[model samples]
Each structure stands twice: as C-alpha cells, then as structure tokens.
Target: MLKKYSATPYVIWSILFIVIPLILIVTYSLSTKNPINGQLVFSFSNYRKFLELKFINVLLKSVTLAFKATIICIILGYPMAMILSKMEAKLQKKLIVLFILPMWMNFLMRTYAWMVILGKNGFINKLLSMVGLNLNLLYTRGAVLLGMVYNFLPFMVLPIFTVLLKIDNNYIEAAEDLGADKLTVFRKIIFPLSMPGLISGITMVFMPAVSTFVISNLLGGGKEVLIGNLIEQQFLVLNNWNFGSALSVILMIFILVFMAFINKFDKDNDDKGGVGLW
Candidate 1:
C-alpha cells in the first residue's frame, strides 16, 4: 500500500544518520590500530583505559554537576510553570516569548555573555567594587553550574507548563466536591499528573548538562574539566578517534541508564494511577 511506502523516507533517514553513526562509533570503541601496519584491530583497550581513576573521576564530576543543575532547574522552573499555567492566556504567551527570546541567540554567544557577566571587573565585580568589596566570581564550579541552570531553565519550564495546561479543571473540581482541600487536590492529583513533564524536563536538562563542553570550558575556564572536555580533546585536539569513540560510548551508556530509570519511575506512577507521588 502507499501508506506503507510513505514511511520509507523516515526509515532511510534513520538508517543513514542514526543507525550508521552508532555502528561506526561502536566499531571504533571496540578497535585499535595495529602498531606494525597501522590498521584497526578488534580490541577492548579503550574501555579498559576508561577504568583509570582520572577518567572515572571526570565522569563522576560531570554527572554530579548535571544532577545539581537538574535539581535547581526543577526547583526554580516548577513554580514558574505553575504560575504561567494560571495566568491569562495572552499574558502567558508574552511571558513565554520573553523566556524563549534568549534561546534564539547562538549558544556560544550566550555562554560568552555569561563569561563577561561573571568575569572579574565584569558587571557584578564592578558593582561590588563601587561598595569597596571585590570578589572572584568567574572560572568557578558554581559559575559553571549557574550557567547550565541559566541555559536550560526554559527546557524545564516549558514541558511542565505544557503538561500543567492540559490538566483538566474538572478533575480538580470533582476532588473539591469530594471535600478535598487545595493542598490535597494538588498532592493527590496535580503533582502526580505532572510527573511525565517533570521527567521529560529532567531528561532534557540533565543530558545536555552532562555532556556540555562549552559551558564548562568558558565559564569554568578549563578549571572544571568534565568528561565532555576530555572527549573533545580526544576527537578534535588529539585526533584519537578510537579513544574518543570509547568515551562517547560510555557516556551514551550512562545517559541511557539514567533515561531508563526515569522511564521506570514514570511507569510505576502510571501503574499506580498517577497518585504515586504521595
């Protein structure tokens, strides 16, 4: 049928882009060059090398920063999303445009703007020096973490906002009719229904935070070297594709595991009629 063939383009695109690239990466991760003839030979040396403490530490640091950023995004964005959902629709659109405006700019430019803002003798430092106090704010872990939260806050807000907007007021009314207070309605209904969007927001924010090189590079000034920086060095600077691919594979695996865990938690909530948040 014509309907069946309509999907052929998508199938071809996935095979060319997704399937082939993943295959190539896996092949590179499981291979090394033969010293004698300079040919790729099957091996696990790269993954073995990943077991080194330094590499493991980098991975741990990346995950830690990402986790912290995700938590902060959730804390800040959830209330904002709730407020937006309650606003008049026209005002909500205007506020959303304001939030999304920054994202339309280049990402590198945004990070550079942060560098200028956070740098010594930059805006904050200059303001402080006017009061006879100066502080070193840039090139710190906190600055890098703050940058991640700044860039990704919209990702967290929009998903939760979309989900909140879809929540039927009739459900709240029915719960209220059953003698449920506002707090009880939210605890037993609203929060649980919002879990899908929360999970999506967490995934969106955490994945990029874990793998972002520019934010760490610019804001942390190479002081906060993350796994992404190492991978970048291997591929672009050092020209070591095998090791770079190995690192990429490991990072992919860790991300997949985190996604799986989030999905499982979401599934559990759905199985419990979305009241598992209590």
Candidate 2:
C-alpha cells in the first residue's frame, strides 16, 4: 500500500511535467517544417542541422565559459568556506547571510546592477576617472566571466560552507595535538572531510553557470552568443522550434553525462575513504 501510493504521485508528476514535455520536445526535434501548413512533420533533419560547424562552435564557446566560471568559483569560494567554518558561530551566521543576501534580490535586477557598475561611463569608470585613469571594460569576454562568477559565487559558497560546518573541530585539534602545522592539519584532515561540500558546490555552480542566458545576454550585449543564446534565438526569434528542441536535448545530455561522471568519481572516493556525498 505504501509503495503503491508513493509510486502513484511519482508517476503522475513525471508524466504531467517532465515526461510529457520532453516527449513533445523530442517529437518536435524529429519533425520537419511544413511551410504550407506552418506545422512540423516527422523527420530527422533538425538534428542534422545541429551538427553544422557554426552551431558546434557556439556550443563549444558556452562550455568553455561555463568551465572557466566554475574554476574561478572553486578558487575563491573554498578559502571563504574555510574561513567561515573557523569563525565563531555568530560571525559565521552573519557572513552566511551576507553571502546569501544577493540571491534574495531579483536575478535580472542584480545583473542590471552590474551593468550600471561595469558599463562604459559607469560607476567604476567614474571612480577610475577620479584617480586620473580611464577604462573601457564593458561588452568584453572578461565582463561576461565576471557576471557569471558574481551570479554563481553564492551557490558555490553555500554548499561548501554547509559541508565545512558538518566537519568536527575535534579533528583539527587532534591533528594539532599530534604536532601538525596549520597547513598540514588542513591538507590532511579538513580538506578531506570537506570533499562532500566541494562536490556539491561544483555541481551547484557548474550546471547553472553553463546554461545561464540572461547574464550573458544583458551583460554581453548580444556580441557574445553562448549556447543558451543560440537556443533562445532558434526557439523564440527564428521560429525554428525543431532546431531549438534538438539544441536543448543536446545540452540536457551533456549535463547528464557530466553529472554521471561526477557521481562515479564520488563513488570511487567513497569506497576508498568511507566518505558520504552530502
């Protein structure tokens, strides 16, 4: 009875939301354009078009940008997580709030805020002018990267911080009592224990950063077109739902494969150390 009830909601929700929509998308991707009727008919041509060199280039660029952003988040967020973990409970709570406050505001509003700060003749440029310096830093690859990092940093920090908080202070004290230095204690004890958080942080940051559209759009000023932008154009602007569906499928598969690989790595690590991925 318990099993039947549990399975019923799962089946209904999956069919209503995930399965139904995905089936429709796949159907669309396999369909051909009927100019006479303005409807799609069954064919494999859309997926073939996705393999064109120009399309491939756009997908690669998006992947590159996402990967770079994820790396930067790890580099900056890990140390911040460590510091937060080591702080007094009151201070740690305040810092966590500060990290999360940006997320409470609307996402586009935050992106627009960055635009005001980073645009030509914007706040930062004005400050630089005060110091007798001139800079034009907008609409570049660097701006897009900065936008991605700013938007996604909280995702990375929260997961890593949660993981670090789970680690007991006694382990660090134990290492120190054994005459281990700070670096040694961290490398040998703290870092290993925080692996779960690190994995969670990587997944949290990488997926959204990879597929994020609005940040790359408004901040990139249409000059930088990532895969998300390409997909958006196909679906919304060009009225080529078939091609857009194929692109969406490809991106979904890419994320699934990447996550599968990460899960396998976690499993291997777990068998070796008895660590759980939280």
Candidate 3:
C-alpha cells in the first residue's frame, strides 16, 4: 500500500506535463479559429491546410536532408566506434570523453560556433583567402548538413561503441579457430550483434536532424527552411496556433511511423542472422 502511494508523484507529474500538453495539442490541431470572434472551434481544416504543395515540399526536404545526414553519420561513426572499441580501456575512455566534450556545452552555443566557423569571414574563409581560393561555404545546404553531423555524431558513436564493447571476445576467438578471417568474423558475428546499437544510433541522429530548425536557420542562413522552421513560424510569427498544432501532430506522426519502421527492422534482425536496414 505504501509503495503504491510512492508512485503518485510521478504519475501526477506525467499527467500534468505530458498528458495535458498532448491533449491540448490534439484539440488545437483538430480545431480552427473564428476570424471575427477569435475563438477556437473544432475542425480538421488545420490538418488539411498543411497538405498544400509548399508545406509538402518542406516536409520532403526535411526527410531527405535527415536521411542523408544519418547515412553519413553511420559511415563515419561506425569506423570510429570500431576503432575505439579496439583501443585500450584507458585510451578508449579518454577518446570517448574527447568525442563527446562539445555536447557538454549548450546546444544553441554549439550551433552558434558552427555559424561563426562557417561564416564568410570565419577561420575557414580566411585560410582560403590566403590561398586566393574564394568559395561560398556558409548559408548553404551543405553547411546545414555539416552542422547536423558535427552535433549528432556522438549520438551515433556512443551507442554503437557500447554495443561493440559488450560483445564477447570468446565469440571472435571461436570464429577464428574455426578458420574464419577477420572480415568473416565481423560479418557473421560482430555486425549482427551490433544491430541494436546501430538502430539506436540511426534513430538518435535522424530524428534531431529532421526536426532541427536552429542549424538550418543559422547555418543555412534562413534560405533553407525545414518543417521545424515552418512550425515555428506558424506558432510564433504568424500566431496560428491551430496550424502549428497540426504541424506538430504531423511531425509527431512522422517520428512515430519512422520509429515503428525501424523497430520492425530490429525485430527482423533479431530473428534472422543478417543485417537489416530495409
């Protein structure tokens, strides 16, 4: 009886924060504002309105950019994680600390630092100017992609590294004793075992990359606006809370669908003996 009461605070907190806010968003999403009276009335017009071409294009662009960033993080981070996993314990800990050090700072500050570094008069440009090579690097899609990768690479590395570290050395030795080479052992054993971490890394990198507004705003120089930016504009600039709520609901749906899709892959990989990304 006493233990049951102990959970009361957490349950109340969840209801107050999570459940109430989600309810309000759903209500606003399925509602409309009266132009003259300025009252919210229940309707689906807000969700329907976002189906227009311009908004769809923004959504597609966000997905594409996030997909590309996730792929790049996987490619770069996998090798790093593998190397780190093979390192001495002390060295691995130090390197992992160094890798995640930047994340200790505020997220906004980290994005701002990239803005400074990628700006026209920033360090890279100054170095390029010394060699008489003028190139526009900032305020571009590539800049935004770079910012995402830099900010979220640790998310990719840490999870995969954790999974890799837990793998039994005996498995590798047994495979080698059975005449399997390094690549074969990895392909047959290590890669399969690491699927959970890889999936986790992909989720961590892709979700933030897709919904990020700050990196696109500062690094893409406001030229590239993602779904996140559009949602922000609706809520803050246009004062269209209904539309913003609809957009938020749509974004939430996208995230949930993606997570479900990845979880399917996770389930398939667990059942089979191969890598599963499709």
Instruction: Quantify all predictions' global Cα lDDT against the true fold.
Output: 0.93, 0.85, 0.91
lDDT of 1 by residue, 1-278 (tens): 99999999999999999999999999999999887998999999999899964699999999999999999999999999999999999999999999999999998999899888878889998899888988888999999999999999999999999988988888899999999999999998899889988998999999999999999999999899999999999999998899999999999999999999999989987876653212
Model 1 stretches astray by more than 4 angstroms: 272-278
* Collision pairs in model 3: none
Q: lDDT tens string, model 2, 141-198?
A: 7889999999888888877888788777788898999999989988898787777778
Predicted candidate 3 versus true structure: per-residue lDDT over 125-234, tens digit per residue: 88999998867888999999998999999999998988888888988999999999989998999999899899999999999999999899999988999999998899
Model 2, which residues run further than 4 Å from truth? 2-7, 274-277
Q: Comparing candidate 1 with candidate 2, which one achieves the higher lDDT?
A: 1
Backbone clashes in model 1, listed as residue pairs? none
The candidate that achieves the highest lDDT relative to the unseen native structure: 1
Reference-based lDDT, residue 170, model 3? 86
> How far does residue 149 in candidate 1 sit from its true spot (Å)?
0.4
Task: Specify the highest-TM-score model's number.
Answer: 1
Residue pairs in collision within model 2:
32-41
lDDT of 2: 0.85
TM-score of each: 0.96, 0.93, 0.94
Q: lDDT (0-100) at residue 156 of candidate 1? A: 98
